[model samples]
Target: MRRLLEGVVPGELLLHYLSLLARGRLSVEEAPGLLDGAGNIDALIREGMAYCHGDDHSMLVAASPDLVLQRALARMAGHLAAEHQRLLDGQERLRAIQAPTDATAGGAMDQLVQILTDGGKIAELTLTLAGSAQRDWLILGARMAADASDATSTSANCRALYESRCVASAGERESVEAVIRAGGMVRLAPRVGMSMRLADEAIALLPLSERNPSGALLIQSSVIVGALREYFELLWERATPYGVPDVEEGPLPPIQMKILRLLVQGLSDTVVAERVGVSVTTVGRHVTAIREALGVQHRFALGVVAVQQGLVE
Candidate 1:
């Protein structure tokens, strides 16, 4: 089912139909032709892009694609939440099973911690943990020259916090941008003292030393994992979203602010214009103004700076 819809409908077509629907430009009469032109009405319906009505199912309607997409995303988030709870439950079960043995062996603390000194083994385990993440994957203090493949291999819901000074190079920026393109969320912190990875809210991988990547401590203790999770969240709230501005800018107009927020969310200029009741050219103008105001040379940088400046929450 997922594979069938992977590339069946172009995003532009969906957004166009939805924009028309929102503006009352798409009547029942117009929906048929547009849906037909889309060439995948069934897939559209499944994705909440189109609706069928009437006794003979002759009536057709276009739905707000954004609303439908948001609902779908909410469902995915609910599933991730449930999976996280299940992992916690399984940890409880394991603790119950190991109670007697742990008492005899001093404690389960020793069992929960594993040290790896080999570089190859550490790298392999990093990928393994990242690839197997089903819920949240939190990365803190990512290196400047970190491999993009590590970030790309994780689930779509990954969040990374990197030191601001580390990603100064264009190559590092590209690597971080690749992560964003792959659906990973990134934030920049002025300083990130420790490098850590938390997977599925169940396990954590911490480098044994800041200067070395060849040694790590893999921990499955809930106490430690929960503490790390809280720490990550604290840093996440304080850190700026990955794009920092080179210059301070004045506040934007309300309409431009609205458009900027939408743009930062990966919406197209066409969609932003439609949503804001402006022309596409107007959106482009506003984008250009925003880029100049933020001292950025590109759209991606514009988004990052908007986020960093609190223009887009």
Candidate 2:
């Protein structure tokens, strides 16, 4: 009952009941039962008045009149909390999607031609190019078209083409950060590498890459663009939005991540003890803590789980 009072306040219970209605987790006819029935409410109210219990009476009245009315209206509206969340998520998705612009077939320049021919297209575009001379040449040509006064493309939306970021080592992460800071965009798997800050107007790879003769596959369709935008947005949402720290040589201290990094470097408890300036026993304590945190029964399994979770290089 103490724990119940701490967590499940009467007001909160009222809100949860309303949320159930909104979430379609509750039904209207069942409201009387959930509210402990009109007869029970009346009996409680009578007891409250007899004992001069103002608080209990207030609770009973609010639950009876306010909650019952709110729940009834919510049921009529067919409110379901899950459905409301979907509508909200859909709105967020729509905000991220660049409106569909005409992307016609003139090879790599199809998107460019479509935008120009349609006119008044002001959506941000992300272009990926392979590390080839022909693709570079095509990028140059596209830049020229983008420079035209009649072009609807905004200079703010045009970002630098970037290679996929590889996270084989911390040094590579530093290089990737430099490129991203210099306005480069990367295509990466969600949760593959260490999280990095990114620009808003970015691109992500589809489940499959498109094949083209020009060596640079132009992406302009709204559905594909929207999907990529959602992925980048998901990464951006999960990533440290601003004030990211620079890459350091060693892992940050006092967490399972730090212990796992040391383990990955082939350091035993004794060697790790000297390096981290803790005693062997203390290092063993850390190892125990890490194993327990990761729920692994053995030391060897710790490394396997750390690698899989991307806690180590």
Candidate 3:
């Protein structure tokens, strides 16, 4: 729900379609396309809601795509042929209802027919990503495009959190902070070697390389997601919370504040001195004072504490 609403659609949608297909009630082709707009997303969402309520029929019947969409679905037959028989069985079951059609039957029957005829293009896209060796690149491009187009991607009812290690390049740092400023609760991890990101329930695992050229795997299975959520909570427990204060508490002297800010940027002591127009000895003194004042043992920890306490921008 987090990833889908937050615009991590390709992975989440693929996971959703796979789960639905696994149910044996529908095939991949029977699923509506991802780029089918809010109409299909809404349909799938309704199906999910119905599933939650144990009313399988509502989902099976409410999302019948029209004839043209069905025709498009037929072209997906090559990949979806395996499920044809099971779907036919379901249709036959529907047909066996000799009783008078209830108010819901008409709508549900149409949806079932639609599902039989539907195949989502977005699902196909994610499938390609899933099998590709270079999926992360494609997924990243898709996410960037979605980010550009979506103005209201986040859900108001949900809490948003991010853990950044600040090892990202300067430009990437700005972007991360922009996301944090936009309703995200940011934290600083002590260190990280993995290339990963989580959007709601979806977890994107990229190659460990700095550039992450190989691709990414977006997993949304319940077991994996739930476990990952627990792991995230554990990591969060050890992370330093980042809440950029409107006003720096205790108001360190202007020079000390400058030093902390540069240090968080991963600046060296010499560079910090150059930037602040202070001598190396003076910069070291301030660094030591900042650490002691924050009750942290080292400058690295001081930087983390500074960001957490909003002592540094």
Highest lDDT among the candidates is held by which one? 1
Query: What lDDT tens digits, residue by residue, belong to model 1 across residues 124-211?
Result: 6677677878877778886412334677676425778888876799877887766554446678999877899888888888888888
Query: Which 10-residue window in model 3 sums to the lowest lDDT?
Result: 134-143
TM-score of each: 0.45, 0.23, 0.30
For the record, the alpha-carbon RMSD of candidate 1 to the native fold, in angstroms, is: 16.1
lDDT of 3 at 62: 21
- Clashing residue pairs in candidate 1 are none
**Root mean square deviation (Cα) for candidate 3:** 24.7
Ranking by lDDT: 1, 3, 2
lDDT of each: 0.68, 0.38, 0.44
lDDT of candidate 1 vs native?
Answer: 0.68
| TM-score, model 3 to reference | 0.30
Tell me the spans in candidate 3 whose CA falls farther than 4 Å from its real position: 1-152, 156-169, 202-214, 246-313
Best by TM-score: 1
lDDT of 3 at 300: 61
Better of 2 and 3 by TM-score: 3
In candidate 3, what are the lDDT values of residues 115-234, reduced to their tens digit? 111123223323333333221111121122113211112322112233354525675466554433332334566553343333444333333243532333345355675565566666
